[model samples]
Target: MIQKGSTLPEADFSQLKNGEMTNPKTNDLFGGKRVLLFAVPGAFTPTCSHAHLPGYVALADKIKAKGIDSIVCLAVNDAFVMDAWGKAHNADAIEMIGDGSAEFTKAIGLDMDTSVFGGIRSLRYAMIVNDCRVEMLNIEDPGRFEVSDAETMLKAL
Candidate 1:
């Protein structure tokens, strides 16, 4: 598992931003910015759609006021699904990035095997990254959403 103080690994992510496809590398997103990044097992999953992403969307202004440069919602789904999910939630304040191949998830050691639910997915997690180095990491246990919600992260900030 990646620990606080570890720099994020290099990876490419696909995102549909402003109705255009964009490919951003790890450094492009985190190299010189304070980023609030949260990951879901899949895009549009029940809890994720109902709570996780919405929490961030609702609190995005406050979070950015706390010095966060960007609020990113990551998932192990394709860019198209992630974009649609973000649109559905009206998450204009959040950047929904897709890790379709789970490369970034596995690199952080947070990947899980979900069998029929999905071949591979990320465990629910939230982290504060500053200039590519992790400052805080909250990784949820299986089927749990305790530590990684936006309210908790806001309080932590």
Candidate 2:
């Protein structure tokens, strides 16, 4: 897992916009800004759909009011799936990032093998990143929702 004060790993992530796929470099998205990034194992899963993602969406304005430049939600799925999920959930305030190959998850040492679900997936985690460096990190235990939830992160901020 990434720790506070550590520089975030550089990688490329895919996002869908207007039916087009855009690949953005991590540095381009997070550099020179305060970003709130959260990751889930998969898109549309129980906890993620019901709690994790919705929590952030509900608090998007408050989080932005705290000087956050962006709120990003990452999942180990393709851009199309993420796009559909975001639309279904009305997640207009958050950027839905697709780590299709789990490259970013592996780079950050948050990879987990859930072969039952598919293959390698990301652990549930959230971080406050400033200018490409991690300022705060919260990683939830397996099958648990605790520290990484939006309310906890908001309190941390």
Candidate 3:
């Protein structure tokens, strides 16, 4: 897992724009910015849909008010699925990042093999990144939602 003060690993993440998929480099997305990044195991999953993502959405404004430049929700899914899930949840305040190939997740040492869920997926985690360097990291235990939840992150900030 990535640790505080470590630079964010380089990777490509995709976003859906006008029905087209566009890949954005990690530096371009996080450089010189205060970013709140959270990862889910999969898109549209029960816990993610019901709690994790929603908590961030609910507290997005308050979080940004604390000087966060962006809030990103990452999942090991394609751009289309991520975009759809964001829309379904009214996640207009958050940027839904798609790690379709799990490159970023693996690079950060947060990849987990949950083929039963849907192949290899990212572990549930959250981080505060400043200018591409990690300032705080919270990784949840398997099937748990404790340290990585929005409320905990907010308190950390």
Residue-level lDDT of model 2, residues 2-112, one tens digit each, is: 789999888999999888999998997899999999999999999999999999999999999998999999999999999999998999999999999999899999999
Of candidate 1, the 10-residue stretch with the lowest lDDT total is 16-25
Error of 2 at 41 (Å): 0.7
- Which has the better lDDT: candidate 1, or candidate 3? 1
lDDT to native, each model: 0.94, 0.93, 0.93
Q: How close is candidate 1 to the true structure, as a TM-score?
A: 0.98
What is candidate 3's TM-score against the reference?
A: 0.97
Reference-based lDDT, residue 48, model 2: 95
Q: Count the backbone clashes (under 3 Å) in each candidate.
A: 0, 0, 0
- Sort the candidates on TM-score, descending order: 1, 2, 3
TM-score for all models, in order of appearance? 0.98, 0.97, 0.97
lDDT (0-100) at residue 105 of candidate 3? 94
In candidate 3, position 35 carries an lDDT of 97
In candidate 2, how many Å is residue 35 off?
Answer: 0.3
